[model samples]
Target: MSTALPSAVLGAAAHQARITLVRKYTSAAGVSTVVVSLAVLVLLWFVRDVQLGAAQVGAGGYIFSGFLAFGVIAAAVLGVAGELQAEREDGTLLRAKAVPHGMTGHLVAKLLAAPVDALVPVLPALVGAALLLPDSMPQDVASWVLLVLVFGLGVLTMLPWGAVLGSVFRTMIGLAWAMMSMYALAALSGVFYPVGGWPAPLQWVAQLSPLYWIGVAVRSVLLPEGAAAAEIGGEFRLELALVVLLAWAVAGLFIAPVLLRRMARRQSGSAVQAARERVLAKGY
Candidate 1:
């Protein structure tokens, strides 16, 4: 017998699905990863004094940590990959395929969950950075809010790509390689230092990196008045951090769905069996 779901029921179901996904992905292991990453930052703070004027330091501390937001997004990638791989292995995906709106509901739920999972670690890291490094924190409440919004948007931009990666590489070994490459690229892309200081070719490479743009946008809001503004040449106005971030978000939105659809179509029993065997042999 067919029964039509009421609008309210549908909405509630969707909301519940999203919350469940967020909780599933935002586990203790994910929190531990965030803590370790923050610990590294704290050690850095202890090693060298990041001098920004009183106001600048405060803002810089908040903005500078924006790159760490990438870690949160990376978690989303891991979640998607892990979820899909596990489901494929267990034949849960086939069961989901039987539902009327199963695939759409699942993806939407995951998409909603990604940001929450990404932000779970950021809140504590931000608080710790603020309390430990008071001088390098933003004093302005409005600026802090703006920083959060901007940083969140930046993280959102990466989710689609993460989704795409997860869908493509439905195995832990594949995911590990992708994650390592992302981290290596981010490190080399001037997240913590000036890329301009690198060799000319490397500098050019940094220009093409998304991490560079994210770092630049963060520094622009956090750095003091006299410090080199996060500009192309110190003259061009760069109020479009949000815009650049949005551009990436739009690209990901389009590409992710297409990639996921392709992955869904190609899913097979042999692939699932192999994935399960691998997982059982090596726990991710």
Candidate 2:
């Protein structure tokens, strides 16, 4: 009554499952990315020529910097955390643990998958903004490189923490708190406006979060030199931005593995079934 599949076949199937999981999440996240990117671009289109700030900053360019930060947050935090929670609840995580090297492949795929899925929403907003308002975006090779560097680092900085969120919060209600935390960061991070304009205490609070520095790095690439007047020190502070973001990346690297391993170890069929029951109890 028991016929085990061949080892080679099992390995192949495992690999296929890994790819399928990546594809599944990527497809699901893509539509949202495209829609949000389009919506932002449309917003950019209307205000392509409008200006703000002491430097007479273009609204399109300002939003581009902030939107870049938001796009990364959506993909890296919300998208990745939610999928991990779903997998755990739906028994995919338990099944992955049962297969040899399956959890390894799953983690690797997920680590890479978030950014790939992130590009779905982020790249379009960036590229669209560039194409429509070339004057407002980075025009030189150097600025563009810095732009890419900061954007890449920001995602890398946040993703491990996102995993931590997924691992710690078994329920969707708890996960929703993570999204709210991001919004709270956005409110204080000066993404939508200058942080210095806030109360002195609030300015200090904004600096405590990584999103503020991310916005600064982005503004450096896209905003005019004169725009620095709006900053607390009237400068870009690129070095500080890099240091904070790098610190986050390093911290995450250390934290994600331990948390993920613990989470994987704890996952089981009964736990997943219970999670599903909780979902049903809430009426979906």
Candidate 3:
């Protein structure tokens, strides 16, 4: 009975979250996201011939792989951070705080919704890639399997830390700065180019970010063996990539709940109103 009751509560919470997500994605704002994704894909397609490395490998495969990881990171980090900040300002978090186990349910909803958030933007890009750059698509079962595995792991590793980011930055302006830093990391992490060409200290910094490892994992499955010549070590370090991503996932598991609980405990109606006033005052 104890287990069943908890399951039922969680299930109900998840259902509510699903409904909210559906409503969000079905709206005009959701259409804008799809359009933006398609626009980015078109831009990438135009640069498909910009080759990289001594192998002179086509950029299409690398772009597709890197963009795939970018989408996951966007949904897990940017999406979650933005949503939490908005919800907090609008009193949603306060309402959630009023209910029993509400914060847990809220977190569950965000985590579950994140993958879907990623897919919405990614699907259009994927279709565009397949149709426009047919050669970039995974041709074999093993490659496809690896793509899915890396993508799932990417989502798991990033979501909790994303929640932490969202919780830490209480204001929208603060969140925007955080997101810009993440974008800078993405650029340095070889999302669109080779990181091997970067300076030693910068290269080491890029490697510390999971974004770089996610790119490595995605590229391992998408690009040909010869393409590894452009990578940092001139080879696909799949084992190290897996270890790095796993370590981030494990760390996030331990860190996220504690931080989220702390964030929730601090939420109040007055705090929400004060945040709203700040936003109004700053015109952000």
Ranking by TM-score: 3, 2, 1
- Candidate 3 colliding pairs: none
| Better-scoring candidate (lDDT), 1 or 3 | 3
TM-score, one value per model = 0.78, 0.88, 0.93
Total colliding residue pairs, candidate 1: 4
Candidate with maximal TM-score: 3
Global lDDT scores for all candidate models: 0.64, 0.79, 0.84
TM-score of 1: 0.78
The candidate 1 region of ten consecutive residues with least summed lDDT is 229-238
When sorted by lDDT, best at the front, the candidate numbers are: 3, 2, 1
lDDT of 2 by residue, 110-161 (tens): 6666666666667777778878889878888988888778878878988888
Clash pairs, candidate 1, are 57-136, 58-136, 58-137, 58-138
Assess the local accuracy of residue 190 in candidate 1 as a C-alpha lDDT between 0 and 100: 62
Write the number of the candidate with greater TM-score, choosing between 1 and 2.
2
Candidate 3 local lDDT, 7-123, one digit each (tens): 866797779778978898889998788886677688767977777667776777777777788998999989888898889889998998898887778888887788888888878
